[model samples]
Target: MLIRNPDISMSKANTVPFGIWPRLRRETCLDSGSSLGYASLVRNDCEKQRQIPVQLSKLSEKTTLLALVLGATLICGLPLLLLFKTGLTGNGGLDLGPLMEAVQSRSVRSALWHSVESSFLSALAATALGTLLALLIGLTDIRAKGLLVFLILLPMMIPPHVTAIAWIQALGPGSPVLRWLGLAPELGSTHPLYSREGLVLLLTLQHSPLVFLLVRAALRSFPRELSDAARVSGSGSLLMLRRITLPLLAPSLLAGFALAFVAALGNFGINALIGIPARYTTLPVLVWRRLASFGPDVLPNVAVISVILAVVALAAILLQGVLQRHLRTSLIGLPQDPLAIALGGKRPLVEATLWLFVAFVLLLPTASLLATSLVRTYGLPLSAETLTLENFTEVLWRQSVTLRAFANSTLVAGVAALVIAVISLFLAYFLAHRKPAHRTWASLALTQSEVAFAVPGLVMSIAFILAFIRPLPLLNISLYGTLWIILIAYVSVFLAVGLKPVAAAFLQMDGSLEDAARVAGAGFYRRMTRIFTPLAAPAAASGAILVFLTAYNEVTVSALLWSTGNETIGTTIFNYEDGGYTTLAAAMSVVVVAATILIMLTMNALARRVPAGTIPWKD
Candidate 1:
């Protein structure tokens, strides 16, 4: 209610809104340059006042981010740290004695040798077969190419243990097909699949699809001009393939081989099922057997073997990286049409051979599983008289353990998927839109997740055991023998799978919409909730589905983590098989396969809405 002085301006004399005084003063000071010092003082005070909210916002964001980073570090980083800690250090401090003893042990040496030899052999076979199929289907005018490719990829989607089981049932002494044809091996005879050769064969069949997918992708991007130029120079098909195609495809072939080799090296299911019986243990199987038999006492020794396995896997990854560096091809523009090779008279023969391969690889094994599931007993042939639905009924309804396992796996996988999806969205946002400093940290966190996934599941399980066997500090709680341990392991292992699609989606997204939102004074949360979430939802959903599919049937990580009362689908199937309940295991596997296919089909229906390349099975 005080009167203003006459010298004061009318604008300065009027009462201002609560937040408008700073702006009015700022404008007046700007208009009159003589008041610059006053302007500086006012501006600084206003900035300090403004910074409170901003600082609080930043503090909140940083707190949330810190929590996320610490969680990831606990899940992914701690296990690896524990592995090195156990392997390199002990109560005595910085000791190499355990590692040296493990390396020199006869069992360890034998397992390492078997792992290396079988992995190399299987990789070679898989690469050759996959490359051949890729060349034939991707380059030539093959009939039903899509269907053939899908069928070929099906084997890779099946769990390794399930593949082991199917092959065992298909070629074992009591094989239904072999018995039907009167070519079954004698009852007491050794099963044909219980050998190193059979192990390699099964591994080759399982991993060949990996090579096929890589080579086919490469072929799809192949320059049409090279083949066209070769043909114009009057080169024959074989010559052109040898010179132009193979040379260009060398990197993909090597990459495929490296991937297959790494996969075989870390394969626990095949090694456990087939190699154990064959007395040809691999490192993964050795680790499992040691831990299962001796408990935590053998953890230090097993950590050394895990390090060896990790070294081999890392070497393969490095080799693939080197190969990929040399794969660069100069392109004028988008890739032209693929070179189409007309088979003409040989088309029918080629198609028949492809179908035969499919029948052998996919149809036969699945048929064997179905037949085994329907049988009354393990060795009983599947006839109208012997066939029964009792195994299915037993596992699905009557057996409480199996029912519990089903429930456990579904609940765990679903929760993992949902949680990972939500976490991945925030991670991807940070990766795509954060400040450079924040992005660097985000990328480092992502690398940890990759390391978790890259390490074999068996090795990861060992790491988790070593890390969490004792009670956690401060909390005084032990996660060692709990279902929470398995859930934590799944999150660590599958984080990369969940992040990939979301990151890809973010990379392809337009930035202007976000910028416009920010310019309109929308906060980070608003922009994310209103713009980013909608755009990235499809990708996140796809990634979640992928995680579910992968975790639902996974056995390697849960093999050692499962306790007596808590069982997973993978563990249950394995236990059934281990306990000589083949029909029951087969019934469970059939249900799992059917569930996987149904989920994949549902995803296929939704694929159109999702970004391309999000679904592994889709084009």
Candidate 2:
């Protein structure tokens, strides 16, 4: 029988003695000899006190994480939705007429299909070529591997539009290729470059290096032991390659293909600079042209296309993410001895073929551009008299848009890089040190940042205009033509790029060190300043430089957004060419290329100074 009192309850029939929770239940109660229960009361009090605060802390952490995730999602996703939604709204309120017009338009259909075909073909070709190049450089002992690798990578450093400009100088409409074909003087009169094939070629050349870099890294990490074992088991090289290497490299190859596809699909710079002039139309150009010619009425259609492009990119990224996770989990952790296979008697032929390919793909266009820059005119007047520094002089003295453009580029890109780098470090730290209760939602918040990269630069710029223009009056700041808008756009566009490297660095770092500092009475910002920042400086620097270059060479976003006198080097170069300043644009390209190379070299040096294991993997 159990009895309840006003102050306490007691059970007399089946009472169990406690020792230590479960252990106590099976043990004897020494206090039974005494008519007292003081020990059990004290034990109960201790346990309850210990758990209450912990439970409360966990609840708070979870609340914080949920709030962060929701906030970040709205910040990153709302602009895109708003940019598109604005088209649905007018003075008459919500309207579906514009949406229907876009859906029913024949030109939009053609343009959409054209963009798809161009991007697919370009990405496929670049991936194939890039994969082959990676094999030659990474798997085999090719001569001049170091030098050739850099040269092959050079195309990636140059902006696609700048590369297009160089190609136009060398191959488009005129010059030696046409002269040899007996049609030099009448270049555009006979041969036109503004065609689908020309756009594909330009995109392929520009994007191939990205594929090469990804595939090369994948090749380096491949488990050659599997291949060797297959060989010893009487499997041929061809069989092993087809069964093993291709499948293993699939993730890397897919990632490269997806990135290239996304770039080609959304790229306005190349399409505008080369394709549009060739009288060819793609989705980006069509969107811009429609926007410019037809005003906001054409926006919903552009938004639809932008959303479609983003969805495709997102799908590809999701696939890549799944494959990467699988690969990590499936790692066998087997140790293998390094093995190098000789080319045997066919070494020279293999070497020659690789060199020939490198020369044609990497060196030829650049060489032609350099040659054109040196010559007085665009022909082969081999005499010393024909060669002059006049073009270079004119570029320097005219104090053309190039000078102002360079200053603007430096200011915008430099500031954007610094801001992004600092913000990323804190974000990474918060994410890495999140409590278990907060981990899930914090991760979700960070994931949305990746989606921004998939959006086309032009689409993002248009969204920026729609979102920012009206809010300026309410926000108490004029951002329309000021450097602030460009700065914000630049950071937003590249924040993911900066965050990924820094976050990876943070994750590799042991949390105990930060915990120790915290326990030792160090505050959040101080601990970060004293510990994590110094430790992650290398990755931070690398990410900042990468962001800067990305912003500096960005034409797609800057094109629609640039205000008068706020032009970047990229936009100005395009403007110069549009205004018939070919020689000056070429000279400016040289300057931008030189500056970019210098920055890259410096970053590589800084990266080398950091200790191994700091970067997670060799990037």
Candidate 3:
């Protein structure tokens, strides 16, 4: 019943108390004492008030997105930039002279060639073995498939240094198993596993599970109808494998191969432990040796080597991207149950063979590790008389270095995990819910993290050294030789690990709960705490655990970063092995392996509460 106020002005009415109040007041003259002057003043105030929040919110969003980009750049981007600057420039101008010199050096060339050769051979071996296992377990009617897969993956979960230590003990001349079986090499003869061939074998064993996981996942989504149709068209088992299964698996195989290649190229433990003894230096080993021997005087040279390593890793990443794009298939609906081929009378033999392989790969080395840990000295044969807990007690109780390493690793790894988990949660939230423009920036920031993670740990460590070797600009304090530098490096290298599961969880989330909280007048923090955090906690925790596991016993990043007081478990063990304390190293490695298994088991216990794919060991 309100008359149109053509004279009173529409703008004044629309500004103050929204349209309803204006119309009501104008129609009824509800406030007899309120004049048009007062109304206009109130309207103006209200208009200003209303615009503030909208402006502030827009500002806030822009600020947050900007901060995320800057933070990611600081953490992940700056180091690589610094590395390149150090490697590619000298004096006051751009120069690739040092890099060229490094590339031309005989030692550098040999190390580069060795890295390429070992990585390629190891990746090929891993791909072949992994594909075979994946087909056997994923497509065939294999017994105890879950248990077998878990056991096979145990090697991958074990730290590379630990694996190297165990294998060293297992195959060395003094091996308890080898000696017991009368197959031990003579004490004066060289260990069989201290060569380039040995490096390839260990790299394959450590990384084969990666290929297996990728191929197994692909096998799970495979269209069973193709196999059925092949059989119906008179294809035998072997023919079906050749014509239908293997062809479809090519992309995954290639992807896995690339991943293994990258992993092997970056390997520090096997390269240092086995390669050094056999005079088979790889690029990572060269970087370590240079840094260890010459300190910062050889920084430019090592930076050049780091760049080469990073380039190789980046190439692998690009290849993986290309393969993924090309491999995209147009499949119908949800994937059906995996095809299970029967083995008939060959089932028993196949199962036996698989179990035997598991025993040889997992059980034997682990047993050797345990035996070596109990011995009084490196070459001492294990017996009732020779066996003692002295090695364990010495490392676990007597040695301050070992205790400090454990404490430092736990503290640093724990903090890194927590910090990364929190940062990743916010980042993932922005990525999942932000506007298109903001998301692009956020994605660009995420790529920085990817670069940090993808580059070899040794290279990343060098990057950090280059970036942080100097004192802070204003604070005038150096982080050059502290645990903080290692912590920062851990955060950079493992940020991607923490982000993956959280981001996956967010992408799959309904968003309705968050939307409802917003509609209910909940603030950003309120909604995040009450609605999003609880939902994403499991995935975040899983990521945190992974970060902790990767960082706790990590040698590669800390290898070059650790100072006298700040030793990591990995570096400590490596030091022990380097210093002829093999028995002590074995003891620590045993504890680490035990701790890793315990953590995985804890995650397994909580699998029901976590998201389906959160725990990798679970079904």
Q: Please, what are the lDDT tens digits per residue for candidate 3 over residues 417-451?
A: 99998888878888887478877888988999988
| CA-lDDT, candidates in order | 0.85, 0.71, 0.86
Clashes of 3: 0
How do these models rank on TM-score, best leading? 3, 1, 2
Model 2 scores a C-alpha lDDT of 0.71
Candidate 2: which stretches are off by over 4 Å? 1-75, 88-97, 176-189, 294-329, 334-339, 375-383, 434-437, 471-475, 604-619
For candidate 3, give the lDDT of residue 9.
Answer: 52
TM agreement with the true structure for every prediction: 0.88, 0.81, 0.89
For all the candidates, what are their Cα RMSDs to the real structure? 4.4, 9.8, 5.9
Which number leads on lDDT? 3
Instruction: Decide which is better by TM-score, 2 or 3.
Output: 3
Evaluated at residue 348, the lDDT of candidate 3 is 95
